[model samples]
Target: MSAAVTPRHARHTPGLLRSIYLPRTADALAFAMSTYGIPLLVLATTRSAALTGLAFALEWIPRLAAFGWAGSIVDRRGASVVFHLASLGRALVLAASAVLLRLHPSGTVASVTVMALAAITGVLTEFSYIAVETAGAAAGRRAGRRAHRVQAVLLGIDQTATLAGPTLAAVLLLAGLPPMLAAITVLSLLAALLALRTPPSPIAPARTPKGQTGVGLLTGWRTIRSLPALGWLVTGLTLSNLATGLLQAAGPVIVVKHFGQSTTDVGLVWSAAAGATLLSVTLCRFAIDRLGQWPVGAACAVIASLATLAAAQAPDYLSYLVLVAVLMAAEGGMTVVLRTLRSLVIPPEKFGSTLSATILILLLPFPVAGVLTALTPPDALGHVITACALLQGLGLALAFTRLRTDPALRT
Candidate 1:
């Protein structure tokens, strides 16, 4: 089941690119729909901020628990297979949820069932996401020296999906919850069909010696530990995610409470931020080519940290929106660089496991950020955000040094 290697000089064929991007874009759309729709539906039905928050948490917390094991499965069984299966499973879940919602529009049972379904979908989504990423990385490897360009294109596709998905969800929600769920179910099915079209990804042989074969869930963690530079990079990304988590947990409150913005205004601001992210990701390939990956990554980190800190002090809604846009742009560029580096460094066999482990680390602090947001006073939110930004800055500095010395990252 090992992947057949392509010649170095061969151009990245259109079919290959489509195989990688189409399914991923569909998955992103489905994800965005579920992420936005579930919370809005919960809030609209239950009229409780606490229940809405719970629904959101249910959609993410399971990812942490499933990451390691999912990665192991991707490695053993092949990413393409896992990707297709997960999408099919998500489609079924969404369809079932839609039917339930139609049957029982309002009740404690319906609400609990929705939350449970969201959690199950979350777990399946994580698996599909990891597998798709692994498959993309494998495709990039086949692109040879153009691998970074392929990565940038894929990242751009993802950013565009991010921009479109939420806006579509918002629009669809006005039509009502059942419509939204039905739309998501259709998207999930489309994603599954796209996955079926993807060519089989090259799989790496077992690392175990001949006549002995076994792999542990922690294999990904061990692989990261063995690579010092990757370890440092993941640590920096984890810190960056901590700052992002704080912003996510507190940004809405800051908008409504501090800026006195309406919910519509809040949505507009995020839409603007998403647009910025899309633009930045589209330009990432050129930036990496001109400046090198490490430098571009370091600059993005600095920019993100500064923008985040500055956002805490914005005097008006417009100023805050501008700062948030800048922050998201920088974060988007940084993510492309990090993902490119991950694809370049990790062995093909370990891609799924290592990436999942990385995501697990990234997600670890989000719950803590939510707790802090709940406990902190509105007046002190700025101080907390500034503190997180500073921590991110320090981690980025350390990561910059590590990258500069890393032989694998040298252009």
Candidate 2:
């Protein structure tokens, strides 16, 4: 009987994974198309860099703001319900935006319409993101001790979608904005349909802890504060992201000016880096099984820091490209470790809220890096990168030291 049950369990696992991955893939592709295509549309319609910049800001601002409410919704509703609603909402938004664009082909009206579309879609996207993340967390829990493997596979899918999404969007845009919008709408509806097939989450809804009145951002904050090890990890990752952000924001400028490479070469550099990251994420699962999350995480942090420092001082484009690949590779490994630990540690009741809060904190550095890059002279960008890298190394050292002694590790 036990042997029969084992085979049945094995048969069910693939169906479960497939149901989750399919919707995730479609949703991610739609998001990627919108993220890339929208800004381009704005620029092409208005031909003003200022308005284009505002469009970009509009998109991200709503996305960040929506995380709070989105998480709350995910906690109140089930992941499947929230995911379906969000995906369908996104489809409606895109279709409506396309109609609006057709009415107002090009002008201030069109610009405002696009910006509004960006903001609305941004919010909807965040809702779906939180829903999927909650679903993933539930799946991770079901995987027991091999949770990292599940996360690794999901991470790989995301990276692959991110790499492919923009290029696919660019191709669709060649025909016209309407075609691109239609494609996104189709993908979103497909995602909604696929969401119905996913296994229902085994986790319960948000529960107010003792002494807490209700679940909210305050509760999430308290949850993080209650988990010292998780707090340290978040802080360390935040610092590391600053360095990585600086590198990313400065990539185009450095590749073109510092290295005398073409703009197309900039894409090549990042494509290669992303490939390395994909490989690293795949390898991290096996590494964690052998060396454990703690040692693997520590090694990744060290490698990322060292690579960042080397990339800053790299004398030529080829060397810089290699170092960037190495940096991203290590970052990928660290991401798997952090995500696996987050699934294991954060309470199911608080997972959605805490995940949103932590993600918001992590994203804060990217805009700051962009601002710093825009203000500084090209020649001095390398110095800033080096400084951030050093800070990353120090912060990670401190965080890991605390983590090594934390009671959570023993658990």
Best by TM-score, which number?
A: 2
For model 1, residues 1-411, the per-residue Cα lDDT tens digits are 223322111112336646777888888888877877778878877778998889888888787788877877776666767888998999898888788878887898678768887798889988888888887787776765566777887788777777788778878879988788888888889888887775542333333221111243476788788888788888987888887888878878989999898878777777888889878887777887777778888888889989988987889999999998998899888787777777777776566777788777777888889898999999999999899989988998888787886865665
> What range of 10 consecutive residues in model 1 has the weakest lDDT sum?
4-13
lDDT of 2: 0.81
> After superposition, which runs of candidate 1 have C-alpha atoms over 4 Å from their true positions?
1-14, 44-48, 201-217
Query: What does each candidate score in C-alpha RMSD?
Result: 3.7, 4.8
Best by lDDT: 2
Q: Which pairs clash in model 2?
A: none
Q: Kindly report which residue pairs in candidate 1 clash with one another.
A: 3-202
* Cα distance off (Å), candidate 2, residue 67: 1.7
Give lDDT: candidate 1, residue 75: 67
Model 2 segments more than 4 A misplaced: 1-14, 199-215, 405-411
lDDT tens digits by residue: candidate 2, 274-339:
899999998998988887778888899999999999999999999999999999999999888777
Q: Report, for every candidate in turn, its global Cα lDDT versus the true structure.
A: 0.78, 0.81
Each model's total of backbone clashes: 1, 0
